[model samples]
Target: MTEPLRWFTSSHSNNGGQCVEVADAQDHILVRDSKDPHGPALAFPASAFAAFIDGIKTGELR
Candidate 1:
């Protein structure tokens, strides 16, 4: 059986309704808008997601 998603938002989120929730799947990282829990989610490979986060931290994504 596949593992269930355990979604959570950033600890720094201020509940401003513009946040996103993330979950770790077996082989992918899932992301979705906090305001739309039942809506569709986007999936990214784990390595790609890590790279994205790194870019954000380094201001390369801005």
Candidate 2:
């Protein structure tokens, strides 16, 4: 049987109205809007997700 996906957000997220939720399981990484927990999620490859985060941290992409 396939395991259900688990979601988590950054602990620092509480400070801001903007928050993101991520699910790390299966072959792809899942990202969704925390404001709408039941909304459709976007899936990306693990590497792609990592690069996206790196870009954000380095201010290469926003």
How close is every model to the real structure, measured as TM-score?
Answer: 0.86, 0.77
Write candidate 1's Cα lDDT for 1-62 as tens digits.
76678999988888787899999987799999989999999999999999999999999999
The sequence of per-residue lDDT tens digits that candidate 2 reaches over residues 1-62 is 88888888987678464688999977799999888988999999999988988999999997
TM-score of 2: 0.77
Query: What is the alpha-carbon lDDT of model 2 when measured against the actual structure?
Result: 0.87
Evaluate all candidate structures by whole-model CA lDDT and list the values in order: 0.93, 0.87
lDDT against true structure, model 1 = 0.93
Q: Candidate 2, clashing residue pairs?
A: none
Candidate 1 to truth, TM: 0.86
Which regions of candidate 2 fall more than 4 Å away from where they truly are?
A: 15-18
